[model samples]
Target: MGSGEHDRILDAALAEADTAGLRGKAVTPFLLGRIVELSGGRSLEVNLDLARNNVRVAAEVAIAWAARR
Candidate 1:
């Protein structure tokens, strides 16, 4: 899906979660499930991509930091 579609789905899920009074521990799972439903499983793919990117960035940062020691 396009970035705009992803943003729309994520915003809708977040709004629903807010309206439902989801807080703290309840928020993550609720938003994730809602996004999956709204995006027809595309959200999971995006989430995996984001997670991979995060890991990659962290690894790069750690390597840089270690090199500075």
Candidate 2:
């Protein structure tokens, strides 16, 4: 990619980081969508992050449910 393309991508990422909402401590989906768009449609990294976080949250929920049972 040319310097122009790189600069544009960087600019887009910075723009996204600007508007991203903090959900407790992490960036929201809307912002992540912008990032994935800017990242040449590479979303697997984001998917992995979401999946990992989901797994942890699910495990916590399951533990809580078991405790209540």
Candidate 3:
């Protein structure tokens, strides 16, 4: 929720985007792990379905940009 946490999530998401190739379900677990680390071991509540969808879209966009380079 802080800037540092947000940056960490973005970094992880991008990494997962490049490596996982838009598979949201596959990527969600990794994202959740990163979130936990960023949150200092505290459990966080998130809408899994929405998170997966967002990650899928983000990964697709990232892939598209990568393809251009």
List the candidate 1 regions with Cα displacement exceeding 4 Å.
Answer: 7-28
Candidate 1, 1-69: lDDT as tens digits: 899998999899999999998899999999889989999998789789999999999999999999999
C-alpha TM-scores of all predictions: 0.65, 0.41, 0.36
RMSD of 3: 13.0
At residue 8, what lDDT does model 2 achieve?
77
Tell me the tens digit of each residue's lDDT in model 2 across 1-69.
456765676677666666664354354565556656776665556578889999999999999999998
Model 1 TM-score, 2 decimals: 0.65
Cα-lDDT of candidate 1: 0.93
Preferred candidate (TM-score higher): 1 or 2: 1
In model 1, pairs of residues that clash are: none
Candidate 3 — worst ten consecutive residues by lDDT sum?
A: 40-49
lDDT of 2: 0.68
List the candidates ranked by TM-score, beginning with the highest: 1, 2, 3
Q: What's the distance in Å from true for residue 62, model 2? A: 0.2
lDDT at position 63, candidate 2: 100
